[model samples]
Structure formats: structure tokens, C-alpha cells
Target chain A: MIRFEQVTKRYPGGREGLVDVSMQIGAGELVFVTGHSGAGKSTLLKLIALIERPTRGQVLVEGRNIGRLPRRAIPAHRRQIGMVFQDHKLLPERTVFENVALPLLIAGLRRRDIQRRVRAALDQVGLLDREQARPEMLSTGEQQRVGIARAVVGRPKLLIADEPTGNLDPALSLEIMLLFRRLNEVGVTMLIATHDIGLLDQLSGRRLMLDAGRLAADLGLH
Target chain B: MRIWLARHVQSALASLGRLWRQPLGTLLTVLVIGIALALPATLGVLVRNGEAVAGRWTSVRDFSVYLQPGLPVEQAGELAASLERRPLIAAVRLITADDALAELRTAGGFAGVIDALERNPLPHTLVVRPAADADDAAIAALADELRALPAVELVQLDSDWVARLDAMLAFARRAIWIAAALLVTAVIVIVGNTIRLDIQNQRAEIEVAKLLGATDAFVRRPFLYTGLWYGLAGGGVALLLLLAEQALLAGPAARLAALYGGSFEPLGLSRGGVAAVLGAALAAGLAGAWLAVARHLAAIQPRV
Candidate 1:
């Protein structure tokens, strides 16, 4: 669950990332944030992950205010919310299994448990056969799936993605979206930021539209 | 507790594996540390061996007390007996004038010259050896006490060179300490700089790890272990260098000792000395890595 109340994010310079944006996504909901390049979708997720703090108001997760969370507590907060990136932010030198195991490793899971969970998460992303393959050796679609497996391997309560299918073809994008849909069905809260308008018609979820760092629309679930 | 130990072991081995993968860089860094450590270690060995040799030489130091002319042999013998009774005196042998003249006639090759004199001129003598544990000051004090006796004319100090050698050894010991301090610092800096470069090369991996909820300690574990490996390997190399140096000097040292009519064995580090060298290397490595990690790891965060 995530709640943002009148949150504004201003950068070091005069530019603003988000202005008076407020929204709430209940637990187990699948939500999509859609906007242009500078529309604050990434900023909203950044605030939730505590990568950057909201300049004003409050950002809550599971009814706890994270705006004033201490610096030392940030890692634990980030661990609870799995994050995927457009660039597949996997360590290129490592194999798919190693990349997926990163989150669980941070959690200090036993080697046996880590092996079990990583394999299962890779299976979910249909990357089971590519466990030992390096990121560079995988197709773009496969790499993104590996990234997804990493984000979910720790069994995070909430999962966030920033243009996860941005580099893929439509068919691959649809496949990635269907994979996300399956994950959501398993009761993981999902907040994905994307601007793929064509893909949105084929997938069903609530949409929050941003314009000029402001929340312009909140389309209810279809 | 088991988990903690397992994590530490895993981190240490992983760091070692990384170094093994990049053999050239690791070897170069380790070699520099080894040479730095060996400089001080060699100096330590020299000072220790020098002190041991000085101790042996000083233990045999002796002085001679010359009695006044016309002193009766009975009184000279009584004076020698009294001197020998002192706690600092190791042994005393009285040589009467007749005995001294006879010894000079047999061994000095000056029998004709000495017989040309109308009277035997050699004074009664007390050859005095100080106790083995007596210091230079105590030996000098004893000599002064002997010189103050009414029948004693002069006290000849034969161990002045021994005192000078002890002074030189003391000075060398101090110099070794200063040199060892400077070299230890050099070792620390070498390790720190190497670790800094390593952190720079792994910037991406660090950022990714941090983003994946890795704590600062977790991210720093490998680099700390990297420093540890460098220190341990460097220590090993230093021991080898010390061994090589001892081996190289063994024959020459023995020959020099033979020339002086004494046996010499070039000494290597003692068991404690070995432990000390390795301990210093280990400490330097850990400290260097800790400083680098503290300075650089905090500056890195996952940037959106």
C-alpha cells in the first residue's frame, strides 16, 4: 500500500519534479503511472523508494510516514519495495542467477533458501534455462525478465517498475505486461510507470496520468 | 552467529577470488607492500643480531690495576683478595713483579732489553674482570674505586671499546624504530591507495548493491577483505624476503666471524618477531581499507 498527500519534489535548481501530487493505491492493487518524460512518474516512485525525499507533505507506505524516515532505515524500506528499471539495472558481469539473488543476499537469506527462491523467481519470469547466462548474452526481452525476477526474488510486499518494457518490441512488451499481470494475481502490489499508450488498451489496471509535474487524471480501474 | 560467520567467510573468499581473477594488479600491489614491510623487518633483524654479539663481547671485558712500586707482594696479594670480595668483581689474579718479569722474558721477545735494566721495573698487577651483568657505569665505578686505593697507581680500562660498541648498538636500535614507523606508514598508504582504486572500478556494482537494499557494511565487506588479503600476502612475501636476505648473508657473516676467531650464525626473525611483522601488516591492511571505505562508500547512492 502507498499514499502520497500533497507531495512536492523540487530539485536543487529551480526545476520541480512534482507539484502538489497526491494519490493512494490500496494493498494488492495494480496501478500504472503514465506521463511524458518529465512528468514526475519516476519522482513519485523515487519518493516511495526513499531514493529521494519529498520536499513537502507526506509519502506513506502501509500507513507509515516515510518522509521523515531516518537515513539508516532507508535500506530496510527499499528492501520491502522491489524496484525494476528501464535499463534492466542488472550487474552485467554476473549471471542471471546471481543478479536475481542480489535482493535475497541483501536480506541475509541462507544459501539454500536463496537458491530455492531465486530458481522459483526465475521460473516465474520464464528465465529458468538462462540462469547461468550473463546479462549481455540474453535478448533484451530476456534481460528485462531477469530484472523482474530480481525485483521479486525477495518476495517484496510491493513492486515498482519504471518503463520496464521500454526497450522491447510490442510482442515482447505484451509478454512482459502479462508476466506482471500474473505477479499481481499472486497478491503483490504493483506500481508501474510507463507511457506505452497502445499497451495500456490491452492490459487492465487503474491509470494515473501526470502532466507538467502535476497529477492531471486518476482513471479508476476498468 | 553461524550466519554472521558464514557471511564473513563468504565475503573474504569472494574478495580473494576477485584478486585471483585479476592476477597482475593484485600481485603488483602485494609486492609493493612486501618490500615496504621487509625494509623495517631487515633493520629489526640487524639490531637484534648486533645486540646479541655485543652482549657476548661485553661479558668478557676486563681491567688491570697497577700497584705502586715498592709495594710488598704480600700487601698486593691482600689488595687483590679484597678487590675480589666485592660483588661486582668476577675474578682477580695478583701478578707479583717477579712473576711479571719472568712472563715478559718468555713471551715479550724483550728478554735482553728487560735484563739490561738494573732492577725489574714491572709493578705488581691485579687483573680484574667485572661481573657479566655489570653495566658500563658500574664497571667504570668499580675502576674508579680501585684507582682510589693508596697502593694502586693506575687502573687501565681495557673494555672502553666494548662500551663504544654498546653505544653504537643503542643508537642503531633507536634508528630502527624510526625507520620501522615510517615504513609502516608507507605500507598503510600503499594499501589504502590500492583499495581506493578498486572501489572506483566497482562503482557500478556498489551502486546496484546499495539499491538492492545492501547496507554500508555489506557493500564494504569485500573491500575490507581485499585489504586483508593484500596484507596477508604482503606479509608472506616479506617473510620470504627476510629469509632470502638471511640466506644470502649466512656465508659472509660466518667468514667474518671466523676472521675474528668466533662463530657467527645470521639470525632470522624469532617466532614472536614473525608474529609481529605479520600482525603489523594485517593491521595496516585493515586500517587502510577501513579509511577508503569510509571515505568513498558514503558518497555513492542509487541515483534515479
Candidate 2:
């Protein structure tokens, strides 16, 4: 569902984020982007999400060139892709239910639909009972699950995460990965960027490795 | 459409709830807006009252056309009849020389001294009342016309004080407009600053919302609503201030008018005036919030 053709990203002052990268992932694929710090993994996902445009070459999603998408169309384009972050990114003042309901609210869904979808998404994350609880009141794992629930509540076609398990312990990190695996099994495309090399065997997915902003390896893609 | 409306309602309530949690900050901001709005509104009310008083005082703008002393009473009566037929002259009454003499003898305390004169020295007079709708310029023009009439010695228009009052009231009205403009601008700035601070405080939330695919409109909804609420409350406070001023001044104003042998009622805001004040506040609030949002919202892209 995503393709990058010889894309290069160079930040201001000539620091290269990604150099001469070209890759493609088909529909419904759960892929992992791995590299050390300062690798181009996050930059690759950002190109797909249209957060930052490529400095050279084309980035396409679902056969559409998103590099040419107008600024006004960015939100709609983004709405089709769910995004999760390492920090959980939950509003501290809102309850778990409210946090999960945010994407639907931003989409301008009806109240009834919002409530129903929020509860269903929370149930998927096994946080149905904690819907009324605040984010700060939840455990670190639970908060991350809430973030996952929020990301998927809109039922986006592609889900991207930038080090989503970075803050969790090994066990909790595995749990989060399994949750992602469950979501992927249901036909949601997943692309996650992480530096945790040990968690790869627990979840079955293609791995694309980056080193010094270069595509060093593409394993399990024969 | 229904879903869109629901989202707006939700945003509005959420903003209101946030302000409610910080009662002191909200109250201080509202008070600042209220005082700004109240200054112009109060001045408007005072100007209206002044206009009301002037209306009562200038109701009758009459002129006296004094005929030559040697003019005959029949000619004066004819002149009064002719003057009454003019379009600008509402009514004309002929005061014959004999009637004037009789009136002076009965009303004036110098009756014996007047009878001591060999003959009556008073001239024939015509009291001409101008049309109620006649403006000052029109009345002056009609007065000049009367002065040019034959046998008329003098045309006296006792409306100079009324004209002065009219000019003063007009100046006051202009001043109110200027004051209202300046104060309205102040209110806009106040609301803009308040919304700016609010955006800064909610920076994290905004980033998250943007990351989650929120359109700029969605992120701006709550701040706009907050501005509207501030404007609404400020308008209410201004109305209350106007009412209080009316209450405090009504009795004294009436007493002062009574001393002048006239009744005065202190006028509060008319329905249109109230609507105007509220509308201005609401518009200013929305504009201020829009400006701040437009400038700052685009700068807060998700860094991740």
C-alpha cells in the first residue's frame, strides 16, 4: 500500500535523513522498519504520512503520489492513515473514552457512532472497564494501549508508529506488538519504526533495516 | 449537517467547561472586556437621554413677527392670515395693538404707569409657529423670508439656544462613535491576547490533535467558542452596568428636571442599542480569536 522511489530527505544545513531510498509494501502487510538512532526509519514513515515531503523522487500510497497533495488535502490524506507515537500522546485532562473518541470527533462523526466505535475500540485494547479512567491514572502499558485504541478507532487503512514501544518494558512491549499483530490480522496495514531488535521474532512481519539514512537491508521480502 | 452541528456544540461546551475550571482567570478576562464595552455603552445611553431632553425642550420653535407701530390692525390681521397659509408656518395668531395694550395693562404691574401715557405705543404682532418637522436651516430660511415682508419691523426667532443645544448633542454623538470604535478595538486586542495564551497553554493538546488528522478548523473550534463566550459575558456585564447607571441617576435626574419645571426620565438602552452592543462584542471576539488562531495554529505542526 506504500511505495517510495529513490526518495531522499535532507534537512536544513545538509543533514541527510534518508538517502536514495526506494521500497514498496503491498496491501495488508505488517512491516517493521528498524535502525539505530538517527536512522531514516521515522523519516520513511513520515514520507508515507506526508508529515515531511521528500527532497527527491516520488512517494506513493495506494498508487497515488502524495508528494503532490495540496496542503488543504493533507488532513483528509492523514485521516486515512492512523499514527501512534512513543509518548502515548493522550490528553491528560480527558478520560480514556474521550481520548479514544478524539479521532472520530475530528472526523465529525455522529455522537452515537462516536460512542459505539470508541467503546468497541477500547474493548479491542482490553480497556473497556478503564474508559472512564484518566490517562495519568493508567499504567504505562494501559496508556499505550489507549493510544493504540485511539489510532485505530477511525479504522484507517494504514497505521504507522514511530517507536511506539520505546517507553515500555520488554514484556509490555511484546504485548503491544501482539496487539498490533491482532490489528494487522484484521486487514489493517501496519508500519512500525523501532530500534528494539530483540522483539522482532515475537511478531511475524517483513523487516526493512536502515543504517546511516540508507536502506541497508530488506529481509523476508523474497 | 447534524453531525457537524453536534461537533460544534461539543466543542463549545468543552471550551466553556475548561474556562469554568479556571474561574479566576476567566473572570478577570471577562471583567476586562466588560469594562471596555461598558465605557461606550454608557456614553451612548447618556447621549440618548440628552437627546430625549432636547426633544422636549425644542418641541415648539416659534417666531414673533413685530409689525411697524403705525401699521393698521386690519393690515396686521391680513398679514397673519397670509402667513398662516404658508407651508412652513404651522399657525399664526394676530395680536392687535389694542389686545397687546390690554394684555400689558392686566398682566404687567406697571398698569397705572402705562395708562399715564397719552396713547398706546405697542405695535401689532403676529406669533408664527414653524412646522414641527422644520430643521434649523429651514427655520432660518423661513425667518429671513418673514423679515423681508413689508410692514414687518422685526422677525425674532428665540431658537438660538435650541440650536446650540442641537450642535452640542451632535458633537456628543460623534464623540460616542469615536469612543466606541477605540474601545471596540481594545476589546478585540484583549480577546486576541487571551486566546493566544490559551493556545500556548494547550500546545501539547493541539499537536496531538493535529497528529491525529484534525483539520485546522477542528483545532480552532474551541478557541473560537471561548472567545464567543467571553464576548457574551462581557456584553451581559455591559448591559448590567448600563442598568445600574440608570438606576443610580434616574431619581436625581428627575428631581433636577422638576426644579426646572419639567419632567425628565432617564433613558436606558433601547432594544436596538442592546443588540448593537452585544453584536459588536460577539463580532470583535470572533475576529480576535480568528486572527490569533490564523497566526499561531499553522506554526504548531507535529514535530514527530
Candidate 3:
């Protein structure tokens, strides 16, 4: 579960990113955050992930106020939630297997467990065949899948993705949405930020739309 | 803890593998470190040999005190006994004029000359052995005091070469220390620059790792290990070079010492010495890598 209680975020130069925004999504729910560019969509996800703090108000995840987490506790707090980026952000020099194994590696899992889990995650993303291939050798969609595998490898309770399909075609975006749907069915909570309105039509899920740093609409579960 | 150990091993091996992947660059960096290290190592051997040689050459820093001519033999004996009682002199032996003449008649090949003399001409002498702690100034002070004694003509010191050898050795020791300090700084700079470049080259990877929930400590592990590898290899190469240089000098050094009717022990690196040199190199590498990683990792925040 994620909660933002009247949170406000302002950038360094006195520009408002998100202002007095409050929202909550319960466990086992997959929500779509839709807004145009500069609509505070990324800021919302960043606040939940504790990548940035709200200049005002509080942000909580799983009942713990992340805004109050100590600096030393940040890494452990981050490990609890999986995050995906639009660019995939996989290390170009590493193989797909190594890229997906980053989270579990950080967790200090045994080699056997890491191998088993990495393979299963790669299989879920249909990237098992390219495990040894460098990320630079993979297609953009495939690279994005590798990023998904990485996010879900730790079996995190919540997944936060920032425009994960930004570079993909409509068909590829649909496939990614379907993958999220499969994950949501398995009870992994997800909050995805995207302006691709077509993605919402395909998935038929709850959508929170932001407009100009405010929560303009909260269309509850359909 | 076991799991932590496993991760450490994995990270260390991964670092070494990365170094292996760029064999040419790593080798060149190691060679630079080794060459820098070799200079000091070779100088260390030289300093040690010089100290040993100086010690041997100065082993007998004695003074031969000649009593005034026509002084009674009993007076010479009394002077030797008095000099021996002084704390500065370890021992003193009186050689009567008759003893010197008898020694010359048999051992000096001067029997024909000795038979022609109506009476003995050599003065009674006292051979003075200074204490182990006596240096040039201390011996000279003692000699000056002895020369002021009644009926004492001359106090000839046999320590000229010893003093000269000590001064030369002292200069060499200072020069070696200065050279060692500079080369060590150069080694650290070389390793630091190499590691800085390595961190810059892996900037993107570091950012990604940080984003994937890696601790700063985790991000730092492999780089530290890479520095360890550099130091280890470089130290090994330096040791080989020193050994080679020592080997080349050992034969000639022993031959020279033999010609001087003395035995010389060539400088062979003791186990402790090897450990010390390698440990210092390892520390330098670790420190240099740590400096680079700490400075750069803080700048590489996760790109939002």
C-alpha cells in the first residue's frame, strides 16, 4: 500500500512539482497514473520511492512514514520496493542475467538462490534465452523486459515504474501492460506513471490522473 | 556472516576478473608501480650493505699511546693500568720497548738491523681499546685527555677510515630515505590516478548499482579489491626486480669481500622484510583506491 497525505514537492528553483497531493492505493492493486508531461506524475512516484522528499506533508509506504526514514536506512528502505525506469537503465556492459541479478546481489543471496531466482524472473519476462547477451545487444522492448525482471526479482510488495514503455510501440506497450496485469494477479502491488491513455483502455484498471501538480481526478477501481 | 563472506569473495573475484579483462592496461599500471617500488627496494639493499660494511671496517677503532722516550717501563705499565681503569677504555695492553724489539727481531724481517743497534730504540706503548659506544667525537675527546698526561708523547688513533666510512654511509642512508619517500608518493599517485580513471569509466555502472539498492559500501567493495590486486601484483614484480638486482650484485660483492680477506653476506630479503614491503604496497594500493572511490561515488547519485 502507498499513501501520500497532502504532500507538496517543490524543485530547487521555486517551481512546484506536486502541491498538496493526497492519495492512497491498497495492497494487491495495480493503478495507472496518467498525466501529460510536467503534470507531477514522476514526482509522485519519486516521493513514494523516497527518491525525493516532500517539502510539505508526509508520504508513507506500508504504514511507515518514508519521509522520516534516516539516511542510513535509505538503502534498506529502497530494497523493499522495486523500481523501473523508462530507459531500462540496464548496464550496457553487463549481460541480461547480470542486469537482472543486481537486486538479489545487493541482498547478499547465495549463489544457488540467485541463479534460480534470476532464471525464473528472466523466464517471466521471456528473456531467459538472452541471459548471456549484453543489454546493448537486446532490442529496446527486450531491454525493458529485462528491467521488469529486475524490478520483480526481489518479489517486492510494490513496484513503481516511471513511463516504462516510453520508447516502445503500441503493441510492445500492450505486451508490457499485460505483463503488469499478470504480476498484479499474482498480488504484486504496482503504481505505473504513464501519459499513454491507450494503455489504460487496454488494461481497464483504476487510473489516477494528475494535472498541473494537483490530483485532478481519482477514478476508482472500474 | 557466512553469506557475507561469500559475497566478499565473489566481489573480490569479480574485481580480479575485471582487471584480467583489460590485461594490457592493468599490466602497464602494475609495471609503473613496480618500477617505482623497485628503486626504493634496491636502495634499501644498498643501505643495508653499506651499514654492514661500515660496521666491519670500524670494528677496531683503537688508539696506540706512545710514552715519551726514556720513560721508565714501570711508568708505562702504570699508565696502561690507569687507562684501562677509565670507563671509556675497555682494555689497555702495555708493550715494553724490549717486547717491541724482540717482536721485530723474529717477525718483522729486521733481525739484521736489530742486531746492529746498541740499544732498543722503540718507546714503550699502550694499545687502548675504547668501549663499544665510543664514536669519533668520544674517542677524540678521550685521546685528547690522554695526550695531556705526563710523559705521553703521542696518541695515534686508527679510526680515520672508520670516520670517513661512517660519514659516507650516513649520507647514503639519508639519500635512500628521501628517495623512498618520493617514490612512495609517486606510487600512491600512480595508483590513485589509475583507480580514478577506472571509476570514471564505470560511472554508469555505479549509478545503476546504486539505483538497484546497493549500499555505498557495496559499491566500494570491488574497487578496493581492484586496488588490492594492483598492489599485490606490483609488489610481486618489485620483489622480483630487487631479487634480480641482488643476484647480479651477490657474486661481485662476495668476490670483492674475499679479495679483502673478509666474508660478505649478500642482502637476501628475509621473510619479515618481504612481508613488510608487500604489506606497504598493499596498504598504498588500498588507500589510493579508497581515496578515488570515496571522492567519486558521492558525486554519482541515482539520476532521477
Q: Give the number of the best model, judged by lDDT.
A: 1
Query: Which residue runs of candidate 2 sit more than 4 Å off their true CA positions?
Result: A201-203, B64-126, B131-155
Predicted candidate 2 versus true structure: per-residue lDDT over A1-222, tens digit per residue:
899899999998999999999999998999999999899888998888888999998999999999999988888898999999899899999999999998998898888899999999999999999999999999999999999999999999899999999999999999999999899999999999999999886666799999999999998843
Q: After superposition, how far is residue A10 of candidate 2 from its true place, in Å?
A: 0.9
B-chain TM-score for every candidate: 0.85, 0.82, 0.79
CAPRI quality level assigned to candidate 1 from its DockQ score: medium
Which candidate ranks first by DockQ, i.e. highest? Answer: 1
lDDT tens per residue, model 3, A1-222: 788999999999998999899999999998999999899999998888777888999898988999998866878888888898999899888889998989999988988999999999999988899999998888889999999999999999999999999999999999998998898899999999999997678778889999999999999877
Position A196, candidate 2: lDDT: 94
Off by over 4 Å in 3: B66-126, B130-142, B149-153, B160-164, B167-175
lDDT for residue A45 in candidate 2, whole number 0-100: 88
Write down the lDDT of every candidate, Cα atoms only.
0.92, 0.91, 0.89
lDDT of 2 by residue, B11-103 (tens): 999999999999999999888888899899998898898888888768868888999999988898888888788888799988888899999
Candidate 1 TM-score versus the reference: 0.92
Better of 2 and 3 by DockQ: 2
RMSD of 3: 3.8
DockQ-better candidate, 1 vs 2? 1
